[model samples]
Target: MANPDECDTMIVGLGAMGSAALHHLASRGVKVLGVDRFVTPHIHGSTHGRTRIIREAYYEHPCYVPIVQRAYELWAALEKEIGERLFVQTGGLMIGPPEGELFAGALRSATEHGLAHTILEPAEVQARFPGFRVPRGSLALHEPRAGLLLPERCVEAHLALARRAGATIRTGITVTGWTADDGVRIATDAGELRARTLILAAGPWLPALVPDLDLPLNVERQLFHWFEPASHPEWYDAAHSPISLIEYADARFFATFPDVGHGVKAGIHHEGAVIDIDAPRAPASAAEGVEMQALLARYLPQAAGRIVDRATCVYTNTPDHDFLLDRHPAHPNVIIASPCSGHGFKFASAIGEILADLATTGETSFDLGPFAISRFQAPAT
Candidate 1:
């Protein structure tokens, strides 16, 4: 029998990915143990934002289409199992120039995957969603399946279900260090624990956890703001509007969410300044709020109201801006699963299942080739 402090699999970081992993592993009857530095569903990490966008026609890559599709199924299953409303399908619009990466990529993925989507002109955009006004010559891809996910609730439900499935969960316990020899040895601030395999899903803290590998992970500071619609609040409601990703300028993007009672949320996609993971996150400054308000004035003038609420989060980015989900090169028993590049929250459900599959069976059906760590390494000279 395994010791009380030991388990078949140990997962560090109970944030979005880690929490889902714990739930999936435990559900499969795996003796899994999960640890986190602070209480999960907290605002300290990237998962705390009240809402995150979920879309099927992935503009990032077509490879993400299948993974996200699987995530949709798992998310519904999770909601049913836990009796919680985790996802809201408000549809989604990918707005940008016809040849821009945002619209072109989304169209490519939708066509490649045979996903149902409609292309709309600026007039149609205004006719269908009055709150938004796209620039002339620009276009929008309307995907019926895209929506938003309540992240904190999703993490809470996953952890709750994991505990119910006999998984051991320890909050406020920090993993100081870890090793992988015959098996896996985890050294925590509390004490030491052992597991047959280990999963590193620490998000921004993942790089420090495996210093020997010198993982090239950049922790960027991102901000999110909520505003009361300046006019026609009903036009920005979920019923009237859909989650939108607008590329207002060449290669620049921002996302907007319909008001879900807390005001309409908006955030720039990837213009954040890179920062130290341990640095105290500065609150949204007046200048930052003004910048966001100005941006909204152009595409979503109705959502350019006073900033009722604002918060900051971090994104661990890889150089290629894709996820890094694979086993450690030197330690096969250890899996590194983070660096989601700001857009990973929606896929946490499917990623959790992939992590659980890797931890238990050493493989998964999903093709993770593009996300492998080796993609960053150079060929041996």
Candidate 2:
């Protein structure tokens, strides 16, 4: 391994966030080097899920509204720049008990952000989305700006554009370790990399990179299953079906993608098992499908099936379930980003922009208060 002596920035992950950061920085003519263990669009990280929810009226919190709106613009811009279909606008629905988090949270965000939404009773919901059958006493909040993001395609486009922007992107090269010397020296599988600043967006491997931070980032095992629709396939199609999140007496998680070739893909966000990145991620098990089936059987039985396919991915999460996007306490040149708590892919583009602003200008326009590391200090581990 030889050292080139210097670079402007070195990104430790080439997944969604890292790739977007690389593109933004590289586009600015910054000499950036991005390293990833595997070529992106691979299933190893959190970005490979076939379909991710993109909703404007954020049920998670209202603070995310500004960043997510920026993300939509970027996503559309990316689709045009790459000349590929990256997103499908099928609108979005949050279905649950009228008082459950799904409906109430959506309503809260809707009111705060002044988002356009519809309060629909179960009968109205079923009439509009025959594929979904909410509980007898449930309600649904429909947001038209919400839809679906093609994860693999988005990653591919971002990296392709990043490399085109003159960033030195190195895949198949894993970072062994990094530390603050004069600047930052990163040891990788292929060579030693030196950069004036370092960005650790290593998702699941973030804690391992900075054990001193004591980040309570749990790598949860999330499973995605593509099932054969029992009936009304067209009704569940992207044009006709809205990406929906259901919170019934049983459990809660969003579902979507209108039969994008494979089928309607779905998963429960927070119902994943705690896992270590080094250990083998559990393969999609029958027991896992059972839980999903239980939800479907109660809510939308027509969507359940002999799962044609399933895959495992990881989400690096904080205790508060927000992101830990902050500069290193001791080494300010180093930054950390794990903006996913089972639900963050929608803001990948905005996150990219924020990382670039922090890397180049030391600040961002968005209110990152909800995502700061201090929010996790007390129970981060």
Candidate 3:
């Protein structure tokens, strides 16, 4: 007789990735169980900023283009399946010096993939978009297929669909520990649960769950600020303004979103204080607000207005800023996925399918070389 608590697969952390995994597995008729320390679609994790950019011409790497393309299809399918709007096509602009990594890399990816894009001079950018004040030497790469994804709604839709497909979801319960000696035994704050396979997608809390691996993961404290438009509010409208990233200096970037009822959202990327996962998050300070406002004042002067609201979030970063997705070295039944390095929310839909494939069939059609954990492992002694 099968134990009532036993499931085909058990997943810890029902954030963007885990929730999508649950939906995929359940749709395939797998008896899956998902647990999260907080409620789904909550503000505690990385998926609650209201909007996340989804772009086809990935400046980070050309390899991501295919996966992100697939992600676009999957996100649209999910929207149709659930009957809710999850994405918005506002287009996007990657602005930087011609020789800089942001513009050059985006151009390379667009050229390589044959994506529809146009290279614009500073004058062209300023003329076409009144919201931006691009520097004289900088250029813009405009891609039409880039826009925002409603992250909280996506999570809710995925979890709701998973539940409708017979998956068991437990929230407000933390997974304290797990062992894989005989099947996978998950020790949670609520109680103990067993499953044939275990997946660890706990985001910042992932390190605590797999301490033995000594994984190279760092949690960084990040801030998101929304500000009221100082002038020309029409320039910050969804139809007129495009999501944009400016590489102000070498390897330094910040992003902005059009005011979607709340306020104009903006934040610096990849440069935040290193923090422990368990430490209390400090609120965004006034000095930090000044710093961001200074940037906006120089680039998009109208956006540097009164601060309406601010929120804090953490990024689980790997040393190289790549994702970690692989099975445990010693335990084949266990899979590890997290440390997205702050730029992974857009790809959650495709990654969830990849995780489902890894958990069930132990393989996927997508290339996992760049995301493998072995790159961080030491040479055999």
Candidate 4:
């Protein structure tokens, strides 16, 4: 039996990645404990958004294709395990000029992986979905197996299953600091505990927790808005419309989701203010809403309606915008997972399994070369 004060593995931050990790580790019969400062599925962090996009033909890199594919399978299995619908299959569209990064990257991944997709010109896009006004020079890459994940429910399900599997969970407690000797010792606001392994999955709070590493993690404030359709409401439904990432301007992109209860959701990607996580976030400005409405007026004109709701979230981005998943350089028993670069929620299910594999075996089959911490380290003189 595991001691109440200690466990085989301790996961910090019960958001998307941490909750999933706890579930996977517990399901494997490993004695694990998950601690979070706030009750999970809360709006305080990055995981509270109602809808998150999940796509297979990844534009980031071909290497992520397999990982996301596995995530899709695991997501389906999770739905089966919980007997609830978590994923909504609305398909997905990558729209931009043929030579632009958005469209080209999606096409490359599709071709390399032989994923089923279609290339639709602007005229075809408008004809198929009258709600859209695809730019004159833009094309869209449509893939069948892309959609949105119910983020809050996903986190809730993971934590529920983890508890059912005998994993210990503590919320409303903060980890102040940690030290490693014979094993890992975590100091929290309530008390201290020890674990053989520690996984730091705290999204934006990661850099502060591991000050020795001096990680180059940037926390950016992002906003997502839900607007009631101004016209052709049926055309914006999941059956007629797919979640889309559109490169409206050169090297600038925004994502749009079909109405799933609240309203048609959309957000500009990665253009938010870089903020200090500890500081109070500035409220979304009227100018920001006007900018978004203007974009919609040009592209998704039908979705340009009165704002039903809006929320702020943060993305802990790395310099390269890729993920950072690896063990601590000096402490092999310690693993660091800062996967949220605005595109990581979908992979949380699979990343949890990888974190479990690393915790138990110290290695994973997934090639984590691109995510290695050494990539950011200075070369030896």
Please write out the lDDT profile of model 2 over residues 1-381, one tens digit for every residue. 123337898999988899899888988888888888988878888988678889988877889888999999999999999999999889888888777877888899999989999998888988888888877788889999888899888988888998898888778988888889559988887878889889998888888898887877788888788878887678777888888887755446656556777877777777678988888777988888777766665666677765777888888878878888888878888989888887789999889888999998889998887777776667536
lDDT of 3 by residue, 159-205 (tens): 99999999998888999888897589889888899998899999988
Model 4 has an lDDT value of 0.92
For model 1, give the 10-residue run with minimal summed lDDT.
1-10
In the range 117-166, model 4's lDDT, one tens digit per residue, is: 99999889888888888888889999999999999999999999999999
**C-alpha lDDT of all candidate models, in order:** 0.92, 0.83, 0.89, 0.92
Residue-level error in angstroms, candidate 2, position 23: 0.6
Worst 10 residues of 4 by lDDT: 1-10
lDDT computed for candidate 2: 0.83
Error of 4 at 195 (Å): 0.3
Say what the RMSD of model 2 is: 2.4
| Candidate 1 residue lDDT tens string, 1-381 | 246477999999999999999999999999999999999888877887789999999999999998999999999999999998999889999999999999999999999999999999999999999999899989999999999899999999999999999999989899989888879989999999999999999999998899987778898899999999998999998888899999989999999999988999999998999998787878889999999989987988988998999999999999989999999998988999984799999899999999999998899999999999898887789
- The weakest ten consecutive residues by lDDT in model 3 span 1-10
How many residue pairs clash per model?
0, 1, 0, 0
Q: Which stretches of candidate 4 lie above 4 Å from their native place?
A: none
